[model samples]
Target: MAKNASKGASRIRVGVGGWTYEPWRNNFYPAGWPHARELEYAAGKLTAIEINGTYYSTQKPASFAKWRDDTPDDFVFSMKASRYSTNRRELATAGESIERFIGSGISELGKKLGPIVWQFMPTKRFEPEDFEAFLALLPHRVDGLALRHVVDVRHPSFKVPEFIALLRQYKTGVVYADTDEYPSFADITSDLVYARLMRSQADVDTGYGASSLDRWAQAAKTWAAGGEPADAPRVTSTPAPDTPRDVFIYFISGAKERAPAAALALLQRLL
Candidate 1:
C-alpha cells in the first residue's frame, strides 16, 4: 500500500511512464487481467503515471476525464507535451502548437493533473533566447486550473549553468533524467522536483537492485523535504532555498517491462 509522509511534509510520488505494456501482463499484472482495467489496477499500486501518448498525438477530452476517474483521488498524472511544440528548429515559432496542445482539453484531468513535460530531441541544442521564448509561451493556467511545466532537455548543450539560470528565471522545472545516455543534472528551479529514472535492469527482480532503491528513496525524500541530495550531479553549485517541494519520480525507458516493479519497490521504500 502507498504511504503518506508525516503531516505537512512534501509528497514524493513514485510511478512508471505509461500503464499499458504487454510485458506487464506476465509479471506486474495478475493472470488473465483485462486490458481495459489496467489503469485502475496500476493506479492502486503506483502514486503517479507519466502520460506519454499525448506526446505523439492529441487525446480527446473524454479520455482525460476517464483517466482521472479511473485512478485514486490522490493519484496524479504528469503528461508529456506534444512533440510539435518541442521537436523543431526554431523554438520561438512553437507558440501556436503549444496553445493547441494545452487547449486540447488537458484540463479535463482537473485536480489529477500534475506537471506538463516539454521534452526536446537529443539533437536540439539549447539556444538561450529561443528557449526563453518557448518557455514564455507556456501558460500558467488553462480553463481555470493551475499548471506546472517542466522541460526534458536531452542535448549536452543544456549542461551549462546558463541553462539552469534560464529555467530559474522562468520558474520552470528541469527533468533530472537519471541516465548515462542523456544530459542529467539536479538543479532546483521550481517548487516541484521531477526525476525520470531510466536505468532499470531486466535481470533484477525489482528492476534496480535493493540497495539502489534504498538510495533513491533517500534522494527522493531529501528532495521532497527541500534539500538537495549531496550525491546528485548538478550544473550549478548554487543552493536552492530550503522549502518543502513536491517530488515526482518515474521509472522510465530502461527495461520497460520491469518499470512497474521498480516503481513499486521505490514506493515501498518511500513508505
Candidate 2:
C-alpha cells in the first residue's frame, strides 16, 4: 500500500505563489523592483505559478502575453478570481465580470490558464441557499470558456462533506490546501485536482517540516492508482501503488525565504 501509485499516471507540476516579496523573510526580490526576467528565471524551475496579484487588480492582456513569452511551454498559470467576485459572494451576479477576466486571458494565457481559484475569506459563512445558487450557476458561467474552476474556502465551517460533494457534482476542482487555518489536506473529491501547500507554523523553514509534501506525494501516488477508492480516508499512511499522473502542486509559503527552498525540497523528494 505504501508503494508509488502515480508511476504511469501523469506528472504533476510544482510551483510557488507569486513572484513578489513580503516582509516575512527580508525580501523576496531586491530592494525596489519586479523584474520579468528574474521572475521567469525562477518560474522556469517550476511548472506553474499562482497569480495572486490579479486578486487585487485586473490583468492586462499585454502583461499576460509577456508572461507567456517569459515562461516555457509546459508552464501553467493559475489566477485567483478578484475579491469582488469571490469574497463578496457575487457568484450569482458576477457573470459579466467573470467573462471579462476570461476574455483578457484567452489569447494571452491560452492553454496555460490552469484554474480560476475562488478563494473565500474565513469570515464568510456557507449559506446553503446562496451556496447552492452559486453552484447551480457555474456550468453556465463558463459556458464558452475552456478554463476549469477551483474553490478555496478558508473557513473551518466550510469543510463539511457536502461542500466537497458539491465541488465534485459540478466537476470543479477543490483547492487541496495544507494549512492550520482549516483542517490539513481535507479529503478531495475530484480527479482534476488543484492544490496549494502553505507552510504551517509548527514547521521549520527547511527540511520536510510541516509542509505536507509527503501527504501530497502519497495522495498523488494513490490517485494515480487506476480504481477510485470507495471513499477518501481521514488520513493516508501510504498511497496506493500505481503509475504516475500529471500532477500540479503549488507552494504558497508563509515564510518568504523558504518558498523556493521548500519547493525544491519537495521536488527532490517527489521526482
Candidate 3:
C-alpha cells in the first residue's frame, strides 16, 4: 500500500472525466458558452469531475464565475495544469513560464481552481535533473493560496519508486490511470490515489449499458464502509483497516458525441 493510506478517506468521490462534446444543446439550450448547466446536471449525481479541457484552453473569469454559480456547494473540480507547465518544455528554465501559467489559472478560476493536474506525456521520459528542476519551479504557495498538486506521469520509465517518493515529498497526488499508453494502476504507486478508470474494455461499455451502474453504487458503499475482505490477511504484515479514507474515482469513456449518455450512465451508477 502507498503512504498516507491511513490519513485519506475510503469513501470514493465518484465522477466522470471532463466534458468535450455538447449533448444538452439539442434539447436544453443552443450549442455552447455556459457549460455550467451541464456541470450542474452532472454534479447532481457525481461528487467530483476532472477538468481536462482547461489545460487545452484557459477559461475566462466570467466563465469560472458561471461555473461556481452552476455547481452545488459540496461539489469539487479537479483541473489539469497547463500543458506549457508540464509538456515537452524543460522546467528549469521554464520557471517564469510555470509561474505565469499558475498565476493566470488561479486568477481566472479563483476558488474553483481545484487540484492542479500535471499530466506528462509518455514520450517525455523521466529525467531526474529536469524533473527536480521542474518540481522546484512550482510555486509552494500561489498568492496566499495553497493549491492542491496532483501529478500524472504517463511515461513508463518514470514509474521508479524514487519518482513516487518525489511525489510524496511534494505532497502531490499521483494519478492511478488504467491505460495501456502509460503505466497501469498496479504498477503506479502513490499516497494520494487519483484513479481514472477509462472504459477501454468491451465489458466496461456493455456493463455500463446494463447493471454495472447499480454495482458501482454498491461498490461505492462498500468502499465507503472501509473495504471488504474485512479481516486483515493472516500472512502479510500490511496495516489493518483502521479508518475510512477518501477515494476519487473518475470514469472516462465519454469522449464521443454520446458523452451525456455516458455521463448519465455513470451518474446512474454513482447515484
Candidate 4:
C-alpha cells in the first residue's frame, strides 16, 4: 500500500507503487504536466506499477479499463487487495470480502493484471490454520484469467519455517520487504518474486548507493537464474525451486524525491 518500484531479465518488472504523487511533479515528472496525463506518462517509464489506490477503495470498471489502456502493451499492474478482507477479526471470515474485491471489475485489466499483493498489518500474527484458510479463499482465476497472489506479512514472528511451508503449499510468494519496519523475508515460494525496497536516500541520484544497486543487480540475476543471494534473509531452510523466477523489484516512496530515479537507474542496469 506504500509507494515504490525493479530489476533483472525478461520476467522482471521495475516501477513505483502509484503515479499520482504531487511531489513527483517537479521531481520525477516534467514540470507543468497535465494532471490527467500522469498515469499515461508514468506507465511509459516503468514496466509495471503496483495499484495502491485499489487498496483504499474499489475503482470503477471504466477506471480500470482506462488504466489498462493508458499503459503500453507490456506494462503490468499488481493490485493490493482491500484491507477489509485482511483487517478483520478472523482471516477465515474474509471469503465474501475477498470475492467482492476480485469481482470489482479487476478483470477489465485483462492480461495487464499481474499479481495481487495481500499485505498484512505488522501486528497481524501468523496463525497457521487461519492463515491457510485465508490462502484457500484466494481464487485462482477471475473471469477465466489466472491470478498470481503474493502475501506481505509484516509481523516479525512470520520468520518461521511453518509460515514459509504454508505459503509454498498454496503456491503463494512472499514479498521481499527491504525495510527495517517490516519483516524482510526473501524466501521464494512461487514462480514470481516480489520485492519492495524502502531505503532510498534523497541525496543520492539513484536513491540507493552504487554498491547497493550493484548488490541488488547481482541478487536479481541470481533470482532470475533460479538462485538466491547468500546474504538475503530466509525463513525456509530448504532450497529454492529449481525453475527461474519472474522478479518484481521496486524502490518505493521512502526518500520520496528519488524513487523514480532509483527504479529507472536499476532498470537501466538490467536493460
Candidate 5:
C-alpha cells in the first residue's frame, strides 16, 4: 500500500475530486454530519483531495489555512489551477494569471499541498512553442515550498512525442486520465504520478466494479515503484527512469455520487 511509507519513500494516495457534494449527505456522509465539518470527515477517510473550487474562483489565505488545519497531518490537497490561466487562447500570455493564482495563499497549504493541475479545454490544441512558454511560467517553488505541476490536456493534439518531450523537459507531469472522453496517456514525465479516473458507473455500488478497482490499485503500486503499468496506453515509446515516485489517484467525474465510495474501496485494496 505504501500509505505509511517511511520518510523519502514513495507513497500512494487515493481520494475523490472534492469533499463537498449535496448527494454525499445522504450516501457518504453521516446522518447528522455538519456541512462545515465535511472536509474534516472526508480527510479522515481519504488520503488526498483535489480542490476543484480553486478552478472557478480565488480563495483567501485564511481559507487555505483552515483547510490545512481541518485535515489530518498526512492528508494532501491537489489544487486545480485557475481557468483563466489555462482556458485562454494564448497560453503563453497567462503568466500574470498564473502568478496571481499561485501567490493567492496556496503556500498556506505548506507540506499538505500536492500537485497543481492546469487543465486545458477540450478544444485547446497543442502549440509547441507557446506551450513551452507557458510551461516556463510555472515556478518550481512557492514560498520555499516545492511545487509540483501537472497538466490535464484534453485535446487529442497533445497525443504526440513533442508534447511529452516538453513535459519531461519541464519536469511537469501529464495527468493520466483513465477515461475515453479525453486523451488518456501514461507517459511518466516527472518524479510524481497524478491520475484522474473518470469512468465510474452509477449502477456500480463502488463506482467501479471490484476487478477494475483491483487493477487500478495494482497500477498505482506499479507507478509508486517507478514502473509503468503494462496495460496503460502511452504516446511515447521512450520509457521514464525506473525510480520510486509518489502517486496520487483521484476518482473524478462520471458517477460523481459514487466517487467517495470508490475512493474508500480503492484505499481498502491498497491496505
Candidate 6:
C-alpha cells in the first residue's frame, strides 16, 4: 500500500516497497529533509506504500495512527505480515503470530489499509495441505474491517495450477515479481492485482527504462480491467474476470534509490 491513483473507473496505485531509506535522501527525498517527514514527503509523490516496518516487528497503535494522519486521505499502506509468522519452521502453526499482527493497530489505518502481504521464504516449497492450513489461519476480518491478503510464494515449485487454484479458493492474490531471481506468477486469484517490480536497474536514471514502464503501465491497465496481459508470466492457463479490479504496484528492492523514479514513471504512463 502507498498511494491510490484512479484513472477512469480503474483503481491503480504505483509506489515503492517502503520508505525511510538513506539512499532516498539523494534521489527521492529533498536535501536536509526532516526524518519524521519522510512518509509525508514520499506520500505526496506516490499513490501508496508497502509498510516494511511491520515485517520486522509489530508496530504500535500510535505509529499506525500517525501514518494514517500524515498521508493524504486516499493514500494506503499494504503491510507484510510479520516475518515471525511467515519465516517460521512450521508454516501451519503460526496462528498466534498472525493474530498478534492482525490485532496490532492495523485497524488504525482504517479504510487506508490495503492488502496484507504474506511473503513465504524462498526455501519453502509447495506443500498443498500445509500451505492450505496456513492460509486458513489468515483472518478475513479484523475488528469488523475487511482484510485483503496477497501471497508472495517465492519458490519456483509453486508454479502450478493447484497453487493458483488454492489462492483463488481463498480469494488471496499471488504476487507477480518481475525478476529472474524470484518466481513470477501473474494469475489474478483475488479481486486485486499485487505486483512487485524488483528488476529496477541502477544504471538508468529511472530504475526501469521508458519502454519497460510503458509495458508495465499497459499491464496495469489490463489487470485493472480484470483481464490478463498477453505478455505477462502466467501460473495458470485460465483468465481472470473482465470487470474492473483494484491494482497495487510496487517498485521494490534492486536499485532501491531509483525505485521511486520507476514507480513515478509507471504512474505517469498510466496517467
Q: Poorest 10 consecutive residues of model 4 by lDDT? A: 1-10
Candidate 1 per-residue lDDT, tens place, 135-226, comes to 99999999999999999999998999999998999999999999999989799999999999999998998999999999999998898888
Deviation of model 1 at 141, angstroms: 0.3
The segments of candidate 2 whose C-alpha lies over 4 angstroms from its true place after superposition are: 1-9, 22-34, 139-145, 200-207, 210-215, 226-246
Error of 6 at 139 (Å): 0.7
| TM of each candidate vs. truth | 0.98, 0.78, 0.71, 0.95, 0.97, 0.96
Compute the lDDT of residue 144 as modeled in candidate 3.
70
**Deviation of model 1 at 70, angstroms:** 0.6
| Tens-digit lDDT track of model 5 for 187-237 | 999999899999999999999999999999899888898899998899988
Error of 2 at 94 (Å): 2.4
**Between candidates 1 and 2, the TM-score winner:** 1
In candidate 2, residue 216 scores what lDDT?
59
In order, the Cα lDDT scores of the candidates are 0.92, 0.62, 0.58, 0.86, 0.92, 0.89
| Segments of candidate 1 deviating more than 4 angstroms | 1-9
Clashing residue pairs in candidate 1 (N, C-alpha, C atoms within 3 angstroms): none
Better of 2 and 3 by TM-score: 2
Off by more than 4 A, model 4: 1-10
3 or 4, greater by TM-score: 4
Worst 10 residues of 2 by lDDT: 1-10
